[model samples]
Target: MKPRDLFVLVGIIGIVLMMVVPIPTVMLDVLLVINISLALMILLVAMNTTDALQFSIFPSMLLITTLFRLALNVSTTRNILSKGEAGHVVETFGSFVAGDNLVVGFVVFLILVIVQFIVITKGSERVAEVAARFTLDAMPGKQMSIDADLNAGMINEQQARERRKKIENEADFYGAMDGASKFVKGDAIAGIVILIINLIGGLIIGMLFLNKSAAESAALFSKLTIGDGLVSQIPALLISTAAGLIVTRATSEGNLASDITGQILAYPKLLYVVAATVFVLGTFTPIGPTATYPLAIVLVISARRMQTNLSRKQAEEEQMEEEQQIEEVRSPESVISLLQIDPIEFEFGYGLIPLADTQQGGDLLDRIILIRRQCALELGIVVPVIRIRDNIQLKPNEYVIKIKGNTVAGGELLLNHYLAMSPGFDDDSVTGIETTEPAFGLPALWIDEATKERAELASYTVVDPPSVVATHLTEIIKKHSYELLGRQETKALVDNVRESYPALVDELIPSILSIGDIQKVLAKLLREKISVRDMVTILETLADYGTYTKDPDILTEYVRQALSRQITLQYSDRGDSLKVITVGPSLEKKIAEAVQQTEQGSYLALDPSSSQIIYHRLNEQVSKAIQTGQQPVILTSPTIRMYLRQLLERTMQDIPVLSYSELEPSVEIQSMGVVNL
Candidate 1:
């Protein structure tokens, strides 16, 4: 053990031994002084603490001090009864208090004991009990508040954990104080009982053993008993007061002294009223003017000085605030702060404020939270916090969604109307205003509440205004999710997977492929609307084929083939049949011949005339598939599948370009048409 710990252990052992050991007078006096000093220090420390938890160890300290005081009482009682003298400290206290009378000293000691036991200790015990009960009751609410803040992005994980720890510490501290207060009460009772025992026992020993007279024995013993009681009770009273201070302390920005002065003396004008009251009393009563007038004048003068200082302080504060504002405006960091952009921002006009205001019954914020969770589940990427704000530059009832500081999609809404989209047919009677469905570009109408039931009855899909915004926002986020997946976000995903598949992650990263290479592969997958939630499979595939090719497109194709079942289920319709437009052998051979290889990678280098003819043929087949109500999926051979996708990416970005290798054997393919050159 360290020296300090050993010292504490030896000190506790000594306190227990003090009851049995015969202490010398000089040593006893020093210990008595040390006890009083300790009590004073405790009281001072309690007063200076701004929060109860700052003095968390006080409960255990209270028990130790109480035990030590009891031990001191035993030793002093022994010396007084047997040797007729306790120590110089006790002798000084006896002479200083009683002088020539024993009754006064005894009466004073009883008063101290009564005050400590009944007043300070009793009140502290009750306060501690109430504080502990209230703290326990509030714990659940505090915990929930912390959770809400965490969910709202108001605090990070580390900050949330720290806040939760603080709450638990507060609960434990108050609970301990509740039990510690009882020790103070018991100590007070013990002091009184010990005093009575020493008095009676001293009287008997002084007469029988010292050959002192009855009166002499009573006088000597009474003085000694009262002195010992005073010495012990004084410290006990200080300690009890400290206990009261600790339990009653509320959280504050300053210590007890500053709070008292800052709050009680907050209004200096109150002193003027007191000054007037004192002057009136002095003038009306015959006993007063000479003594009261001087005090009243001093109070009035002090009040004036305080008022002047208060006014000057306010002026200085205002001036400092103005200066700080000016300095901030001139700072370079102010301009730099403006340049930073949010990853995703939802800006709306003033008229659409009700959609986001909670007090106005808008659930947009709550809806955004759900949208983020949905994106994470569907796309396997954490969506950044969407910044929502009102932009006066836009028309009222208009909203825009921006990705990385650029507006990508926008729409206008009628808050009091429902958007009704046609179900492959229109209802003439279920119309209010002409509009287009923002999410899917379908023809829709803004119908009022009166026409909502009519539209629903007419087989038209109906949704509220908030639903419209939510659908649009969710689609836009998913469309641009690839842009949000940078190195940092990829690192977070890798770290998360490392927790479960440490060996797999360790073997794959920085050896077979770096994070940038993995990010490129993942981005390609997201761009094609693929979910990377099956990370273990994705990582295993990368670890197997990553050594052969560092090209993201090639790796992506391999991952796609490995995830054939998932892709098959994603696009397959009823009866497990995939209806698609197939690429013919002539075009596939032409594209395969046009593939140009370099040190960097492969690219499609077909001539412009051939590309135009190919686009013309591809569009005709895609249109034919759409006319038949089948999604336009182009099925090509695995060798030129990625090259075909690269050719059609800019024009047919939304279309699924699948290869034969990316389909399951159980899935049957039904070709609608063939694209040929």
Candidate 2:
């Protein structure tokens, strides 16, 4: 063990021994002096600590010191009653400090006890109790604030953990102080009891056993008892004062002495006023100028010096700040830093600032965090951190969402108005500006609050401005999610899968296919609005069919066929048959025959007139399915699904094209319409 730990163990053992074994007066005096020194050191350290938590061990120290003093008292009581002499240190206190008068010595001891037990210890205990209560009560709020800062990227995880640890330490320290104060109070009472017992026992022993007169017994015993009490109580008073200082200390950057000096001298005018008052009191009042005039002159000089120092400090701070700014401008890193870009950016004009400002009760940042988690759950991809800022180049009520430094979607919002969309019928009765919904292009209107209740009564869906922006951002992210899944994200997904399906991951990655190939397959799924959350099946299917073909499109078709159940459940309602649009036998045959294949890829080798005829027929079938309240799904053969999707991608952006193999066997399919040429 280290020397300090060994010393502490030995000291505790010695304290227990002092109560049982009698010691010589010389050794007692040494121990007595050490006790006084320890108390003084504790007081000085407590005074210099910047915060109570800095002296976290002080509560345990208080208990040890209090026990040490009591042990010393027990040893001295034994020596005085048995030998009529305790130690030279106690004798000196009784004679020199109390002027050799027993009554005076007893009175001084009483004063020390009252000051420590009544004023300092009692007050410290109350303050500690309240502090502990308040700290525990505020812990949850402090923890939440730390979490908010972490989410907002103000502090890293390590910094947040450190701050939370400090808060916990503060609470524990205050609670310990609360219990430790009682030790001081009990020590004071023990001192008083020990003194009385020594006096009575000393008198009885001296008169009855030693054949001494009553007066001599009383005199000798009184002096020793008073002296011993004084020695113990003085240190007790110092320790109690230290406890008060510790419990009452507020958090500050500097020590107690410096904090007091800096704050009090901050305003020189206050000192000037005090000096003037003192000067007037010395000149006009009955009090003479002998003492007051000199003190007033000293205060005036001190104030002038303080004012000069304050001015110099302010000038130095301003100069330092200016120099720092100039250095930052000349630094090469400042210009090079401009190349960094946020992966996602949300920019708004000045008028819509309140929608993104947390101070104004806006929850846009919080909503953005939820959006990221939602995407992770639904799309199986991690969205990048979005940087929100105000751009003066845009119009005052407009906002834009950018993905990888390019604008993908933009919209306008009215702060005091709500956007309302009709369920189905036209509502010309509502008075507002007609606009299209930014997320889906559905017809919508921006109406005032007065029309909100009326619009709801009219069966219109109403949404606030922030929600509108959030919804638009969500849709944009969902549509362009394929562009966001790079190789890094694909690696993360593989690592996650490795945790559960280690064998499957090991066989597929870097063996049959690389991370780049996996990313392409995942991106293809996302482009078709398919979720890659079912990674086990996708990886398993890829492992089975990956060696047959190196193309991502072909690999994705195999994965989709393996995930037929999930795809079927996604589009069909519960307990309802699947309604789909199909191509006629003649048109399907024509398209199947038009497919041309090469080593690079396959392409449509159909005539332009036949392509036009196919596009027009598909549009007519899609329109008929939508008019019948059916989702526009085109079911085709597996051989032509990719080619047909590529053919209709630009013309039918909202329609989902599926192959017959992509459907589950349990789901019943009903053909709603067919495209014939």
Best by TM-score: 1
Instruction: Give stretches of model 2 more than 4 Å off.
Output: 1-34, 49-89, 95-104, 107-194, 201-213, 239-343, 348-388, 395-399, 410-475, 484-523, 531-633, 643-654, 664-677
After TM-score superposition, the amount by which residue 669's alpha carbon in candidate 1 deviates from its true location, in angstroms, is: 1.9
lDDT of each: 0.93, 0.90
What is candidate 1's lDDT per residue for 509-582, written digit by digit as tens?
Answer: 99999999899999999999998888888999999999999899999999999988889988998439999999
The prediction achieving the highest lDDT against the true structure is: 1
> Candidate 2 has which clashing residue pairs, if any?
none
**Total backbone clashes of candidate 1, pairs 3 or more residues apart or in separate chains:** 0
lDDT of 2: 0.90
* Local lDDT at 69 for model 1: 95
Question: What shift in Å separates residue 482 of candidate 2 from its native position after superposition?
Answer: 3.0
TM-score of each candidate structure, all chains considered together: 0.68, 0.57
